[model samples]
Target: MAFDGKLLANLSVLAAVVESGNFARAADALGLTASGVSRAISRMEARLGIRLLHRTTRSITLTDEGERFYAEVRPLLVGIEEAASHAGGASLSVRGRLRVNVDPLFSRHVLAPRLPEFMARHSDLEIELITRDDLGDIIGEGVDVAVRFGFPPSSSLVARQLLETRIITVASPAYLKKHGHPCTPADIASHTCIQFRDSQTRRPFDWEFHKGRKVVPVTTHGPLLVSDAGTLMSVCIAGGGLAQMMAIGVVQDHLARKKLVQVLPDWADERFPLYAFYPSRHHPAAKVRSFIDFCLEILA
Candidate 1:
């Protein structure tokens, strides 16, 4: 075994490569030539006697060994950088990227509007808010945290209860006036009800109602099926159909402006819990902690 700095360099290069997903891009990011990056990987593989990456013209894929090595070394590199910054007395006012996944409606009407205040408080923090209605694996997706509706899944993740949400049925006044109002759960069967379909569940959610110590599920028919809650709310507002949505999502303007009227007020269930989830709680980063605290303070 000879002394070689190439091993450490290659590890860094490998991280860059994986992060960038291409040799040319990785080289550009690392300020190295593409051939130089390839040579580094080759020499490092020769030194370690292992194939770290599978390369092709179209794409690069990491072998099992490459993945193992990356998982081991990536955190070490991050630690080294953090230690260097710590030794230099880096500012503690929440710096670094905060990757958050949240609902589109929440992101649009709730979080995005108030993000400037958070950004002002954390001047050094760079927040990347990814909006999606679909659920994602936070650990696999490399997200810092996610704001999810309902209870935490049966995963080894840490979750903090942020807010309680109530499901409500809403319909436009014009639609209700033309079609008349439904008095009971059974009335939904004949009316045009907007159905919200979950991608993961692959099924339309039935309108739920409660009656005097009894639970009733109504299977409604509708011409419009929607995945996005924003669109569903819009369709309901435009008199397309009646929809069941979270109170928080539908309450602000409609309840005040009288565009959408809440129906079945006494019948909807109150099982929705908004949660902020992270992969782990063991020595959480300051950025994650600050975001969670903000959500708790503002939303809870």
Candidate 2:
């Protein structure tokens, strides 16, 4: 079958519909009327002799054929768009949807607050930020970039070092006043310690401390064992217990505000590295590159 401009246009509409999850939303995304989008899909289905979508009163879902077709053609569609942008000399225009997967704590404490400035700089760019503790498959999820702790697990993707932040032990002033401050790492055993658990493993993170060349991991217990860093920090600020956290923007803000006091400052020595992981594409979309650079600048 000869593929014409109309077929390409309908395919684009189909992709928009699949991405947006509905006819109306897809229409809005493509700047077309709902009826126009529906008609385009109907035309494409008739021409291709395949039912692309299963439509209910409330929602629309792709048929098996539609799913397979989308999976094969979506990347091609993205490439075509990128090519058009480059051909039109709009390669510098950061105008597209940018889907990013980010660590929950980093998103909450660092990226989220800085997003407005990034958006203001690139007005045409749309951002979708998914924050979670676990690092999911970025390519499978259609994520352009992932801001995560540690290095990228798979060598298939390109990884860039964002920053290495020091982990510091902290406690609320009220908690310290009530229980007395722990001057040494060994004294942590006497204090109520808030523990952070690995989301995947369900094991508590051992608090690490260093003096000169000697480093040790101290196992401490508490009433609260949280899987979320933000919640753990909140509990510590509310006088729950001593918590060790990455000394990033949010922690520094809290420290400066006197909300949380650094405990065993001399002993805090562990560094957590953050990375920007993305697909190993030869030419990433301008939006992705722009956002990564923006993050690096703000984070620097």
Candidate 3:
């Protein structure tokens, strides 16, 4: 097909439909009628001699061919939009939907409280945040950026280090008073320890501690194993057990109020690095770049 204004318009419509999940929603997003959007998609399919979507009365899904085609065209569409915005000199006016995937603990404790400021700064941008502990397939899930803990594996996406926070072992003051504080990592075996399980792997996270250039991984048994850091913090606050958690997840007010006490402070030398990951940036969207810079500034 020859590259022209009409072809670009139709491609834009196709991208919107796939992103929004329905013709009506895509039309609303693009300031077109539902019938107009549907006609454009039908025209494209007829021209290409391929069905792009499997549609029913209630829902619509991409066909296998549609998925591959979208993957190939989506980045090109983004590049075109960026080029157009630069041509018009509208780079400062960042406006679009930004989908983010974040760890549950980071979402609740670190990002959630600070989101109002970010939204206020970029009033034109729309945000959709999905919080999960496990690292999902970012490209397949249509995530613009993902905030994750620990080191991410090598992948197609670009990874930038946000920050590293210390992991502290903590328990309620009442529990520590009743059970006595642990003097060494080995002493945890005699006390109640709270555990966190990997949501994707279904395996408990090993409690790591460092002392004088040596790192140790301790296996702990607990009455409760949780997949969420917030819930694990709550259990620990109620004197359920000891928990090893990132400093970002620890409530400073709780520590000041003596609701939670840091145990093994000398041994709390392990640090976990947080990263913001996104797709390749041959032509990075303004919305994604702006949001990432905003987060880095806030977290700095």
TM-score of each: 0.69, 0.69, 0.70
Q: Write the per-residue lDDT of candidate 3 for residues 1-300, one digit (tens) a residue.
A: 565787778999999898898999999999999999999999989877899999999888889998898899899999988987664543456677789999887888888988998899888889999988777898998998898887877788898898998888999988998999999998988888988886656988888888768897887888788888878888999999899888874566688788999988889788889998998766567777887887788788
Q: Please give the TM-score that candidate 2 achieves against the real structure.
A: 0.69
lDDT of 2 by residue, 154-192 (tens): 569988888998889999999999999897788998888
Error of 2 at 193 (Å): 1.2
Query: What is the number of backbone collisions in each predicted candidate, taken in the order shown?
Result: 0, 0, 0
Per-model lDDT: 0.82, 0.86, 0.85
Question: By TM-score, highest first, what's the ranking?
Answer: 3, 1, 2
Q: What TM-score would candidate 3 get against the native? A: 0.70
Off by over 4 Å in 1: 1-93, 211-213
lDDT for position 182 in model 1: 89
Look at candidate 3 and tell me the lDDT of residue 16.
Answer: 88
Clashing pairs in 3: none
Per-residue error for 9 in candidate 2, Å, reads: 21
